[model samples]
Target: MAFQWQVDPEDLFVERYPQMVGTGLPAADVDEVRAAITDMWPDRSGGWVHEWSRLAGRYAAAGSPWRAALAYGWAKFPALADTPKRTALSRQVDQYLLAAPDFDVAFDRIIVDAPYGGGHVAVPVHVLTPPGWSAADPVLLASGGVDSWKMDLHGWFTELALRTGMRVLAFDIPGTGETSMPLSADRGFDVVRALIDHARTLGGGRVAHLGISMGGYFSARSGLAGEVDAAIVLGGPVERSFDPDRTWAYGMRGIVGNALGFDTEPTDTELAQRMSAFTLRQWLDQDRNAPMLVLNGADDVHIPQADTLVFKGRPETEVLLIPGTGHCAVSKFPEALRIMIDWLVASARW
Candidate 1:
């Protein structure tokens, strides 16, 4: 609960910085992080990594494991296949594990068979049993976005665990975090299906999927594939998500490009074709899907409102569009999370 690091409201990096600071750092330590990041503005290397790493060490030395973990994670944000990025990621996991005991959760790192390609991959799943949890209780497979890894969503997982007494399994989607799989346009839902299969073994063959941002795309797809009993897609893109004509910001484009394994940024046309592999509209068959809830911010820049609109009148689907909020309606995350959890509980009961 040390997420107090606040960035300036008017900061140019406001698009990504606020969530970065809000989710990962303590409020009291906000100034130091802000100052360091400011000094390293427009630079992802050199002093930037050093500043965050030093800050992380300071927090670790002070026994604030969560802050340390977040600092390390920030050090690797907008990940690149580099030594420093890899080191920061490893340290982030280490600090997160160091903080897990305090939260009363048993963290386990394991490997599961990827449903595609006949390959095995490592997935770090955080396991938390809420009070009154039973072996027959259902499980929630929680996931995060491109910039925010599974570690970033730990708080959300704990909230779901407490709210429903369901065992929560937090894992990275195929391309992010410690998931040992190559990133591809068609990689996510298969990985999630594999995870759902794994979740069933832990909880009486009952599991639900909830995902944020790009993970929401996978959650929606999982529901369409009947991979899970219930699914919630928060700020996920379905139709326009692949349209080259839909304007995307530099950072958003970077994330999509990077996730698809491009060594360099791809042309908009190439990016469109690459992303086309993920378009769900063409594959959707309403009769074969599970009940789903699609929610997003009316102002979400990365995901167009059209994405949410396309789900309208779809069988067993409900959509919530909040005005004046940004991507995934992250500004209303706590409220949205409550709604998501309640729906999951109700969906499971049905």
Candidate 2:
């Protein structure tokens, strides 16, 4: 099955400051600001630049205000509004994911070690198989949750490996797992890369990578880093790059991460600010990693399913559109695991 990168672009969404965005539209105020910016800089990208000129003359009209608000979302959080570190934002976020009972996790352990010297750290990795592991299988990980575990692990990872041979190695990111590595731009891909290397030493076989939901970030990251033999991305987000101003939402997290600097990794509000400038799209597997499978959910609120499903180059890649699932709805469709097993078999990457 070849990956198809075609779905409605509208389904793609990167939730930014739900509290702020949830606030009534900042359109009215933003229009005034955009007009001022356009009049002064004249040279800019986007349709708003041209529209501003027309709106400038009709500033008195009711519709003019709407036009000016074109860049309100971007302006409200201009990448440097910097979330205050009033308290430990990292700890708060940690409690939300790791400690949150609603997450419903069943994993091997809280911390893990590498085969060689790569610096030890705690990674929340879920192994599909049990007790003693085998070398004939593969390890995989995805960005989203529930579905990845229920859909991929239970469905494909175990059966395929037990029958033909393969295993799944799924993990949450640093900030996501025990290692509270803030999702900084400079350090996003490094997490998957590390996992790939460690998996090779531990499992030692043709690695099959799985990128479900938000895991699309890790999928492309590990792929480009040239570690996995094959990749599977479900609802991959292929935007130009990180939203540059994504840090404004991390209110007071700097004080949280830095205060416990010794207890946690060194991450300041400035780093998060810098991260806003980059997006996950900046990194793509291209041909460096081949034999990829993309499963898309039509209503995935996080990563839209339409962007990276085409067969540009690869060992091979394919996309399957599941209509009922949201970002984490793979479990709803029983065919998901079967689709993946068939893909690996057809690609001969298993």
Candidate 3:
């Protein structure tokens, strides 16, 4: 069966354009690529991947590796399902590495062993250390959603490092980006635990976690398990999103399926069955939890509001529902980032 998109691809392009620019893509380049995209799925000219790749090549030839990386990032934009998209992801990584040396903050890309399914998987992580950072400072493990992987979040990570004077560790969550493992609720936690363990080795061993979008699910799990010093869940689903009766909006179902490592789109029943294993309800009743901050836009179309509300009565947890915004409070991200950074600084002191 053919994959069906919940939202029209053309409309999605228009809706996501602002977010692309917000995340650091040049406006003029994005406009050119947007104008060239007549087919969203085809692999040839006028297709999403083709046009974006064309722009990426131009940027690369012009000695603008960062811009090339951003363009290639959009080429792989929602998922890495097809060959062209996967190729785009490869180029994205190459361009990002090429641009890394010029980053304002110093960083190191290291590989750590993450235990998974009776063995270990090599996980690539980017650790950025701010000026004057020392062993006495704290560390933060940060990650983005299924679609926006580690490289896509470089700006946010750098900003956090610079503003907080904390070492920022960024990695792709399981089943996304360069992670070798597929998404399985039980196994995914193992990957996160491994990251936490590695994080504890850096700085003062005071570690925090910041998860955005689907990445928030892992952060919530780490918090509930008391694995990190603090955890930030920004627009992540904790419970209701996995309910069989819950519905997805704006093509989230298919997008999630692709991130879940599905070769083809799964039926609603199959999706629900798989997703149910991801809910954190069983852990909610537990007494132990890290200091947690749960945040999301009140009108998030992707995640149910109940997911953020679920933390209301939990001890040592702060929940914020930004009004008049959408998922992750993208429209008001600067405000949200300030709140998150302040919370992290305070959490570290404790």
Prediction-by-prediction clash tally: 4, 29, 0
TM-score for each prediction?
0.89, 0.51, 0.95
What is the C-alpha lDDT profile of model 2 across 183-299, one tens digit per residue? 433454566666777677556656767765446656755555556787777555545323433331212233223312223333445444544543544455345556667776666
lDDT of each: 0.73, 0.43, 0.86
> In candidate 1, which residue ranges exceed 4 Å CA deviation?
1-12, 38-46, 347-349
| Better TM-score candidate (2, 3) | 3
Candidate with best lDDT: 3
Clashing pairs in 1: 4-25, 4-26, 4-27, 5-26
**RMSD for each of the candidates:** 4.6, 15.8, 1.9
Off by over 4 Å in 2: 1-110, 113-120, 130-133, 141-165, 240-282, 285-287, 310-315, 328-331
Q: What tens-digit string does per-residue lDDT give for candidate 1 at 1-350? A: 00111123224246766566567576556566556554332235334566678788898999999988888887766554456666888898889888977875555656666665665565667777777788887888888877677887777778788887888888877667777464555655667777898999998778888888888888888877778888888988777877878777635666666666676667789878887778887547456577888888888878888888877787788888988788987777777877787787784433
TM-score of 1: 0.89
